[model samples]
Target: MPLYLLRISSEQTSFRIPSLLSIAQVFDFPIRFVSSDLFRGVLVVELQREDDVEKILERDILVLSATELFAEGASYDELHTELRNNMALFDPYIHTTFRITMESCNHRIPETRQRETINTFRYTGLQGEVSMKAPQVEFVIVEDYEWEVANTPEARYARDGNFVRVYFGRRIGIGRARSLILSHSVKTRTYYGNTSMDAQMGFLMAGQALPAPGKIMYDPFVGTGSMLYAVAHWGAYVFGSDIDGRQIRGKMKGKNTRPGVYRSAAQYGVEDRFIDCLTYDVTRGPIRRGGWVDAIVTDPPYGVRAGAKRLGRKEGKKPLREDPYLMDDGEYSHQKPDYLPPSRPYELANLTLDLILLARWLLVPKGRLVFFLPTVNEDYDEIDIPIVEGMKELKFGAGSVQDFGKWGRRLITMEKTALDDGLPPTFEDHDELELTKASGKLPGHYGFNKRYAAGFPPRKDGNRSESATPPNTTLEKREEGME
Candidate 1:
């Protein structure tokens, strides 16, 4: 098995490994790892075939570049010796037009020093044109150095900041970095919301949920259709539903109308892939059939940024009499007679339970249900995540976390394994479920405000400060409208 170098992005490091593994499984390509330095962002793996490089690249959104490793060493002396001994590998490219690209972790080398280093390879064999332009072959030199040690005068004297390991490879291919620039970006889209999922995360979630093309992807809480955009881009026909009609149908303010998710699909040239988007709440169970949708990719509201609400009763609300004459649509009226349904605060515990139940009822066999579950970093329990009766847990991990505070979201992907024989599993002991209904007197309820305030601070009118500490008010104040 030949070794290949996979260079992945530093951002969202936790997701990159599992995503690659899942993608390889979906494509039936085995990802046999030879070695990996997670901190240095390097992975050496063995692929079944050379063409599997392109297959991995097509699915992986985090991978930056891939290469066929020629030589690797722990020190400069070892690298020099290895290159000298491995002259046969470079024999074919020696006389051909080539360029050397250098990358380093925790170390920066001057161009003069790099050229001086490249000069060592020059004396190895036949002379070749050093084409800085388009080259017949491109070789890469990557160095990984200790990040904790600074490049001080004393450190430099002792070679303390020297590279820990060095890798030499010929560039074979790249990942979806370029494609994500246009197709996956929300900045390029016409519509977005406060809780709209970002392009990279959205696409990654879509990839995890819908592993194949021509699949029917559904997002019950599709705000701004961000996830739907990603799913559609991956060749899946997407349909979604949102409780708030304002999100689905942006707004019709006078003569100018701001179109929502449906029209936004045209920007990516995947308009046909977007089947429909309904203004219906997920808790109401709009999906009547079972085993229809191939995948469910959603970013549910976490009691902030977006409020979790469902149609319910309101106290002291009087029923208004409806006049048939006034309700006539063809007649010219001062305003459109839109029927507004009353909504109440939906319990977080019930909301998640509904999502799990919906996934169980709607997802086909082997179809994945990928969704995000927000939690406090300190209280993050994998067991707290809801378990559907018949769904098989595929992958679950903290996809992202706040740098300054104790807030994070886990990406839970489960596949439907069998039909529910009786009923869904109950989550009585789950800390999140208990905290949702309990008062501040409870143990876990104390950090509810702090956890919610981690990624998003309490809003002062419109502005939000970066501080993670909640305002002087109690957790009840922070939970005012979040429910």
Candidate 2:
């Protein structure tokens, strides 16, 4: 095994490690981390091959660069001693065109002092040409000031340890995977909405789906094709369905000022892989069950700016028309060109449970279900995650939280370990695409939406009261019985 130092971007520190681990699992590459700490700015890992490290860097947006670790130390004196002792590590690059550079994590190394430090490292005798412009290889010296730094004295947790850590390695790849973010940024996309998925999160979700050539990925709550576009960019054929046709098609009707899901895919040159975008209510859609999709990735509406909806009319509401009438185009009154289907509120709690159940029947063996779960910071728990009998083979892979003051949302990756023979059949398989199959009564819990609006109330001992939490629903509880 070869050791490598992975420099991670400080942005979205919580999202950094899980994404890397997901990439490794996708490629079936075995990696041994020196330490499995979640927020380590610099990671030291033992990889089977250097080429595998490059492959990971090419897909990971969090990893800034990959380097072959020659030595590390707690102090400059110890660092030089270790580097000198392992002179053989630098032997190959000795005759090759190379340049030496110094990098800092929480501290800055002045250029004059960096040159002075590079001069002191002349002990490892070499007669290589120093080409800063087009060096065949680059050797980097990293000085880590740890979590505490001179900038944020208020956040200092403890007294600074001596030197913290230092690493010496040869750089291999830089900014390759990270460049994908700039390519899909919402600011540059041709078609986007107020609730479009963020570029970075979309890339992370797509990666979690383990997309590859010949694989098919789907998004049930696709909006403006953000998630699918990213998946298509990674070589997967993507299709999606949304309750609102305006999201798939253009909200505004015009040719020159075009705004549709297809335009966004074309913006990134992935229109070919962006197979289709249809309109359907996920709860009652006409999708036949049985492990057909390779992966399911989506950012379901959380009822903040964009609320969730299902095909159904509001309770106690009277129909505008008493009897159906044929129109001039020989169509029913409700089937007019301007007719809009009626819908009812679909809360996050039940929608999330149904999504998990849907994944159990829709994803292939070992396929992954990646989505976001928004909850109050004080009310969230692993037990709160929805699970059913069919999801016995569904295992939680990773969860990364994006905290916002009193509340936070977690990006959840649930992988289907294997097909569940005892799993129940789909409910909507034999039913028509109508809300008559569902009850009009709404659940007690409205999920993050109601809580966010009322302002999150802190829970005692990090546990939710039974009356306050949403009751779990299963496939058997619905009217469509499983046989």
Candidate 3:
């Protein structure tokens, strides 16, 4: 087995591990973690082949770079001894045009010190041009130390006494994270809504949901198709449906200044991967046959920035008997009638339940469903997660939550574990979705929506709580609607 070192971007510290694990699962790649500290932003893993690194770089947006590790040790003397003992193994790279770059985490080394360290290996039969401009082979020497050492008087956490670990490797490849970020950037995007997801997060969702190429991914609440852009970029043909036609077709002004999701797709040269997009209320959207889509990825509205709405009629409303105008052909006719259907406030619980049920019916066995579920940190209950008979929760630990000020949205990833038997879940199995309670508490009060509106409650000292949780108090009564 060959060992490799992975350098991850420090941003999105929580999402890195799950993304790595999910990508590994997708490729069915057998990997063992050598350095497993998720927060350290570096990973050393054992893989069977070197080519698999390219496969991971293709889909993972959080990884910065990867290297084929050569030698590692807790001390410089040990590492030098290992390299000297294994001179035959180092002959291939040492004889080629190569450059060595130094990297450190939680510690900084001066250029003088770095050069001094490199001098220790320079005399060991190395016969390559030190090409600083363009090297045929690139080598990286990483020195990692704990932040505690940086603040202490005993600072130089080098390999002698205080350093945590040291790595020496041949740089193999860099991740496509920068290009992906620029590709779907909202700043350059032609059309987007207020609640449009960030490009980085959308790319992560695609990685978790559609992992492989040539899969069919569908987004039910595809407002502006921001998420679908990521899915299509991953080589999956994408389809999207939303309740608002205006969003699907960006509103036209005097000229064709603004185009919709398709225009954005065309801009990215990914129109071939985009199947189609439509405007339809997800609650009554057309049903797909069993095993229709490979994955379902979406960012459903939580009524914070965008209202959560679904199509339905008011109580006691009846269908019209006849149309107001008729053509000579005896057909109800209108040249350009702008008729819109009525919609009601969709309950957060019910909306989530519907999404799960839809996935249950449409997803192929082992197909994934990745979506964001907004939750106030205080009321977030892992047990309250929606239960579907055929689906299994995949990633639900720390990597899931992307936090804001006291409010955060959790990314829920589920896989269809079994075939749908054309049956509905029993009452006791899904009573959580129902808004009824003897206390007459509205559905919104118990979940993310209510917590968002109330914000973080004030402490006993009358200061707002900065922690993820609010003060331990019951929520006050409010209107029966989402935030």
Highest lDDT among the candidates is held by which one?
2
lDDT of 2 by residue, 399-425 (tens): 477788677768777766556523433
Candidate 3 residue 388 Cα shift, in angstroms, is 1.0
Tell me the lDDT of candidate 2. 0.73
Off by over 4 Å in 1: 123-127, 148-161, 178-183, 253-258, 314-337, 396-404, 419-483
TM-score of 1: 0.80
Candidate 1: tens digits of C-alpha lDDT, residues 76-112: 6788788788878887887898888887766666677
In model 2, the runs with Cα more than 4 Å from the true position are: 148-162, 251-259, 319-331, 390-398, 420-446, 458-483
All candidates' lDDT scores? 0.68, 0.73, 0.72
Better-scoring candidate (TM-score), 1 or 2: 2
Please give the distance, in angstroms, between residue 427's alpha carbon in candidate 2 and its true position after superposition: 6.3
Please write out the lDDT profile of model 3 over residues 266-352, one tens digit for every residue: 888888898888778776666545677899999888778876777664447764445455668775553433555566667676677
Best by TM-score: 2
Give each model a TM-score.
Answer: 0.80, 0.86, 0.84
lDDT measured at residue 113 in model 1 versus the true structure, 0 to 100:
68
**Global Cα RMSD, each model:** 8.3, 6.2, 7.4
